[model samples]
Target: MYQHEPPTEESPKEYKIKHARIYILLLIGQVLFPNKSGNTIHSKWTQFVVDLEDCGKLSWGFTVLANLYREMCKSVDIKVTEMSGCVLLLQAWAFTRMPIISLVAPLQAPYPYARRWCIKKLDYQNNPRHHLQGYRFRIDHMLQDQFIWRPYLGLAPQRHEDSLIWSSTTYIICFHIVEMHQADRVKLQFGHLQGIPEEPQCLVEHHKMTTIKARQKAYTTLYSDEQNCWLHRELFMLDGD
Candidate 1:
């Protein structure tokens, strides 16, 4: 129940709190983890907003990243016409890690590192396909040293608790979608010496369960194995030097 007028000092405290929660929910759905239909938000996220106190403890960044990975994987199908998830995150990752292909100069911004690219003004390409081809060519020719594997080293907040799980090899659970966060596969990104990672986990069943028909099903029922894997993520973590 949102008010047309902005909450004033006279407004009830509960009403103000509810309004703030609503705003946050909208932001999460629209900007953070938007689906193919940009205008509508899935009802699954409403549970998180019901108790704002628990929000901080949640691995939201990991969830967003996992969703993006899942969406990208789905988009590989030639018949797939629409792509979902945060494309901005993808761009920011590319810009930070592959600076040679980045069109704009990096801004010296604080935490929430994606902001560094937000305020930039870039020249629009008349033909996007040609521009994409150029990016592909540049990426193909990129040297090993040219890639900034440890781009956010010393920039991430050391005190933040979430940083502990930055390199945790586990499944990132988002509702019915359970995607693997194979941190061991990208050990160099975490400033660790690359080693032969263990065999990848088979998640074919999880992928099959994340279809449109399965969206309404309970996440716990579908992803109990994934939840167990996440709980024991320390075992999966790479023992890199």
Candidate 2:
């Protein structure tokens, strides 16, 4: 996935290592945390790959979720031409929770529930708008009983154990990107009683800090403050008990 031409012969050890890092970054950009730029990997991710071994220790799932939330929010702007981030997550979420609109039946899989809809070569391009309107109509008229509020209930016990923190109300931080995980607002997803959630935390300044110019000027400060927010994230939860 590196931009450079392939070497004619076996590469040097250093060259091989560098190529591997580039490949990993490509996977991150194209799959995990894709942006609107398509295949163009951002330089900001270089620091994470510098110590390749430590990359596994990072909270990559949270980063993906944070970026996806940020991109979805940004898509509200009428001027925005393209949406980005791991949109596949959104699709998988919809398929799992809104089964009436799901094209394929979910498989009885263990964890990584997204794999259930791994049907290849499904033609969604045939009358795309018709499908879109159908989905919209279903969602718009969906009754509470038709929605699978707790779709994972029948999954293996181990899956539930592994996802204990899925309902955490906290700030998901990934460098300049920080988005609130307002789990309290969506308690039904976790089989909890729903209550009127308070107004969301004001993150306007933090959002502004993510701008290119602002990131250049205060990248360290922004990341530090985000990290601090994450560290004390329990305090941000709506429920005290």
Clashing pairs in 2: none
lDDT of 2: 0.74
- TM-score to native of every candidate shown: 0.84, 0.78
Among these predictions, the greatest TM-score belongs to 1
Q: What TM-score, to 2 decimals, does candidate 2 have?
A: 0.78
List, residue by residue over 92-199, the lDDT tens digit for candidate 2.
Answer: 888778767765533454456676566564434422335668777878988989788887778668767735477778889766777888888888776678888889
Candidate 2, number of clashes: 0
lDDT string for model 1 (1-241, tens) is 3456778999998888788788989878988899887888888788888878897678788789878888888999999999889888888888788867765533576656777555665533421334778788878988989899866655546644344467888888777678889888889876689877788876777777645756576656766787898878777765548
User: In candidate 1, how many clashes are counted?
Assistant: 0
- Clashes in model 1: which pairs? none
- The reply for model 2, stretches above 4 Å from the true place, is 2-22, 106-112, 120-130, 216-220, 223-226, 234-241
